[model samples]
Target: MLKSLPMLLLAILITSIVGIIIISIYQIYVSTVKQNKFNVIKDASITVIDRCGSILPYWLPLLEGLQNFGQQILPDYPFSLMSLYKKTLMPFVIVYVTNPAWAFIIFFILYYLFVRPKSPIPNRPFIRFNVLQSILLFLINSLLGATFRALPIEFRTSLYGLMVCNTLFWFVLLTIIYSVIKSIQGKYAKIPVISQAVRIQIDNQS
Candidate 1:
């Protein structure tokens, strides 16, 4: 039991890191480049909220800070809205790879030291979702990165199809994951057609 505790903790940490990475990507992208369509922003926000919800009250403050920053900086930008959106989230990119683990550690400490003892919700779903999301993101990103690195430089130069498909697939997957997490929290999550897959997963798990 003692040995398993560390492993379990590590799993939770890794999962939180992946979720942070995904949110970092979305935040940076949206802040730098303005999306004309509301759907795009809504989808991205839902993903952010779903992942952020796990971390609880901390996320709310961080997001509020970001929003305040946006109000101050966005109006002064000269480029297209999309470019501005991307720039805002750029700071988190390095954290995704560098101290990714720190985000999870902080969250775990926060929960264990405070929330877990007071909150009525069971800890199992929260821990399970964090672990599941992190493992999935780690596998997907590592595979994609490895595949891209293994390909010849010349091959990558002409791989627009691969790039496009990968981006689309990632966005879709994020939406699905976010929706599933929301459902698990007993919320009504709507993510177009992808919510069906999340429902299927939840059903199977139960």
Candidate 2:
């Protein structure tokens, strides 16, 4: 454990930083690209679902279908409201609310059961990253709900902060995962934090 301290600390730091960047990018994407909300949501959702391995391919089509639906219906609605609704409603609201605790449960079970066992990439940096991220998100969301009873301004701000953090965290996590996988597969991987953590974890595990 002592020997692994650096990796653990690095993992936490990188995950938090990447998570924030992910949320920021999502905010920027939604704000700037007025027409790509559906596509952006679909892409982000698919990225998360892909982490579940082969059992989740079926949801890919469902996400795509929803994207198609959004593309069709969203144009008729006000852009700002529609973007806000999609961000708040579809990706985060409906999916998150319906599943509730499943993300954390699934993440842990899959990490120890499937990911650790199969040892797909031989380096499970993302496992730790994802674990921390999921926990943080759960806490943030819970806090946001409780804050709704306080001053309305504070509540709304808290809500936005949560969304921003959630979006960015997943974005960075997904990006890191993708880059790590590609690098393992002999592709050019460019995510510095993930790549570094993957190396450390792989070395430690070995």
Candidate 3:
């Protein structure tokens, strides 16, 4: 019990911090939406569906990347997200792993379709915002993955490495889920530094 006390406390602290952040973000979002009521769309269903689709292109590649990262490092578990993923989504993963170029192709396609400014194509603010967020996530994942690969081989297979990889997976999963939920509610997902950067990029494009 004594040995676990610190871990328990750490878990509690993390939970509290996450709760506070979520509530604060929601409050700020509500206020912002109120101030920009005219800009906010009342018809959320259509927009929600479209916005949700924005992340799908990024999601598969991220999934494939995680699985590849864990190839030799992670041990076989009878029941885990990766295991379940393999059981159900192996086909998609295989395709992505085999042809990594598809992620880049999709990225370019999404940018041209939704993110490009002043072109002959139509632009959508909500979906465009989500797409940009997804793109940012993909880039961050790729960078971190490269950094992760730079670590010593022994350390890469160590418990700490597993923790790092797990953290990345959780971050990707939770962010997408949170973003999708906000999209479903016709609200923007404010992902701290990420959303701020996206906002600046959007402003520049405008």
Winning model by lDDT:
3
Rank by TM-score (best first): 3, 1, 2
lDDT of each: 0.45, 0.41, 0.65
- Best TM-score goes to which candidate? 3
- Alpha carbon lDDT of residue 119, candidate 2? 51
**Residue-wise C-alpha lDDT for candidate 3, range 1-206, written one tens digit per residue:** 34434533443355455545554575468559754875644553444345445434445435545654645433454458557766654545555566667667778887887788854455667778888888888788777788888989788778888777767766766776777567555567899999899999999989
Q: Every model's Cα RMSD, please? A: 13.6, 16.0, 13.0
Steric clashes per prediction: 17, 3, 0
Give me the runs in candidate 2 sitting further than 4 Å from their true place. Answer: 1-93, 117-188
| C-alpha TM-score for every candidate | 0.38, 0.34, 0.69
lDDT of 2 by residue, 1-206 (tens): 24434533444355455444554564566557843645533333323222322212112222222332333344446889677857643653244335535444544654564335355554434344343333333344345334433436553347575454345434433653554343222233444554455445445655
Which pairs of residues have clashing backbones in candidate 2? 19-169, 22-168, 23-168
Pick out the ten consecutive residues of candidate 1 with the lowest summed lDDT.
60-69
Better of 1 and 3 by lDDT: 3
